[model samples]
Target: MTNISPIRVTGLSGNFDMEGIIEASMTRDKEKVDKAKQDQQIVKWKQEIYRDIIKETKDIYDKYFERYSKNNIVSKNSYTSLSIKSSDESIVVAKGSAGTNKINYQFAVSQMAEPAKLTIRLNASTPIVQQFPPNASGASSLTIGDVNIPISEQDTTSSIVSKINSLCEDKDIRASYSEMTGELIISRKKTGSSSKLDLKIDGNDNLAQQVANDNGISFTTDGEGKKVATVLGKNLDADITDENGRVIHINKESNSFTIDNVDYNVNSKGNAKLTSITDTEEATKNMKAFVEDYNKLMDKVYGLIVTKKSKDYPPLTDTQKEDMTTDEIEKWEKKAKEGILRNDDELRAFVEDIQSMLFGDVKDIETLRKIGISEAKDYNKKGQISFNEDVFSKAIVEDSDKVYKILAGYSSNSDEKGVFEKLKDIIYEYAGSSDSKFTKKAGIEKSASANANIYSKQIAEQEKNINRLIEKMNDKEKRLYSKYSALEALLNQYSSQMSYFSQGN
Candidate 1:
């Protein structure tokens, strides 16, 4: 039996040992980095899911409150129509009663019917005090076209008129000399509502006085002008009248009112009692019109909630996807129904009584089933509820207040948890740390210091792993070096013996 002596292990080189330690440290660092990345990804996913739930829930809540539950069922059309004709010229007619009043007048000229021409001339001989260009307040001497005419206190009308006619003889702005009063009467050749024939003055310079003296012509100011009226702290046109008698037409021009043989002065801010009569037929018509509006709204709500399939139908098209989802539709219907259902028992009872009064019978769920508002099985054996819109509309008309109460009560119970509060709780449950085994193992902390402690532990764990790897690598390297050193020594010893043997030989 050959006895093998154990070889003495030698120390490892610094380069060999240090390289192994570095490689082991690098491996452990890479693992920690990967784990951190995965942890971050998990957190991100949790946040995203939470956000999506909150957003979808909020959208459903807003649609329920803003679109279906709001009160907006009032009619606004209550009026009567009237027609009038006139054959006179420049005659104003006021023809309408306090209720359902209207005014229609016309002006006719026989000369306008034929192709006859009329001429009116304007002559400006003496300068008139006219407002300067741009600013109406500045006073300046009148200049017709390009010639400047001067006005004196003693200037005669004829001389001034002659000067004006000579300067503007064939201009479109014609000036004709009047021999009756030795004056120049200025008028436009064309006469229309918009024709500029009135004299323009500088502020309160009294252009009438200037024209009277300069042309020796007498003129009178038109008494009719724009009139203003006010009612309920709102300004309105003085001539406007409510033909239907639904709205009170308060005339601002009528400031004096006789009350019990005593006169009272009313101003813009004051209120006056209108003793005008109303049309009962028109009022009823207006109320009936509101019924139509209410019906339309109810139909819209029903359509959104109810789902139906066509017989022998094809697959849903892309366009169908644009419609509301089943979940959304269900939520909307529930909200609508709730809004119509009043929470207050008294109000609910009152609405029910009103319905009873209108329909002569209370339509409960059983009654609705008898009237074709019950569940029915389709060809696929799936159950679905069908609504009777006509019956539902009659029910609504009979008891609108009941319907209103139901709609106003939707998703508004005070006892239920608020959406925002629920969302916050969900977030807290998902993100918060608790004193549980799973949380502790996952390195979740209750306090800020605990978080810091966890981080410190992770760091220490990483360092310990690195150190263990270094120790393992160092042990392997030491064994490798020791074996190689021993082999090298044995080989050298054999070489020396061979040299001695050769020398001896």
Candidate 2:
């Protein structure tokens, strides 16, 4: 019977709508299945709401705890401002902290540093074959400072120069030969006392001497014939003097030097001065921004904790929603979701803990109120913090170092971590770790969602059973029709026989 298709036999002889009657009888059972599906949907809505709240809280945590908390809220350079002036900036320039005293100096550059070079000028008639040491393994190897440059016997002077420059681009050295002078010049790239060309050859090799004589290099010492001017591989020898005519020691390797704890960097010969002044305006602005961000986060969290729960509005079912419009459904769900996280103990405790930390005492400063930061006095304000500009600015200007430490100090005790660090600790406790409150709640919601899925599957199975039962009912109705049709044929034959006997009488 299950293998056969259920016949759709209309009530012909019985004159009745059997399918309609069966549907009316099953309406109550169908509504029970629909309600189960609606309950699952309500659970899904709850999971979504919890997830959104967690996401919002995580966003706040990232902004405050991750980005700005670890930094110095008070600007580092805000206490002392340094101004620099150079008479000849092309020669020298200076920037850095100016100590308690003013700095004044006059600098001069006598000469600039140079690199060592060997320029070889070969005659056109000469056979320019490279002179390698007898122990050299091949005619293609040129070793310089443990670095080997491969060369060929057929390589020309120009090609060798190009190869040397290419290979030594990263080696802090370069080689070039002038076509007009026919000189091969190898020199260090930088000009300083430390920048010296390290050129060495085998003791048996006389390549250096041959190149020097061929390149017209003078080897005559001082007082031999004439005074020889300074050459490459020598430091820049310059005399810099202060206003007191005292010699100031300056090196070619660094442009800047510290005098009386004040640093100065000069590129050209010049006179420069450094003056120190207080910078209170910038420090005040930074303090203001810190207070503003703190108050904003505080307000956000407080509002969420105090949200009112509406017990009258339960999650709407599908049947209930069918009679309502889209806007009506939205408004009803909004009220239903009002108290999902309302008066939550975890959130309330977190808020209270943060407030305690903010209002607590710090080293030297004692309390935030002493630094001109205090909570709102109004009961309706919900503990929003306020900063007095005059008092806070004066505190920063007078003792910025102390004020800075009070807010950003590192401490193992929660009472000592200062306001910002304490808040950061609270955020990490709630949202930072996988086992934190935030993650644990998300896990609970996830489990609830899984349970809702099981409900959905159960409801689906019930629906399949309902469909099977309807098929069986239709099959029974079809068999009843077959039996009624046979009975009608028999009755009609008996009535005809009775009429025939009456006619014979």
| Best by the lDDT measure | 2
Residue-wise C-alpha lDDT for candidate 2, range 226-289, written one tens digit per residue: 1121224544545666557788666565445555545555554444333334545555665676
- Best TM-score among the predictions, by candidate number: 2
Q: How many backbone clashes can be found in candidate 2?
A: 9
Compared with the true structure, model 2 gives a TM-score of 0.49
Error of 1 at 458 (Å): 16
Name the weakest run of 10 consecutive residues (lDDT summed) in model 1.
226-235
Q: Candidate 1: list runs displaced more than 4 Å.
A: 1-29, 61-395, 409-505
lDDT of each: 0.35, 0.56
TM-score of 1: 0.24
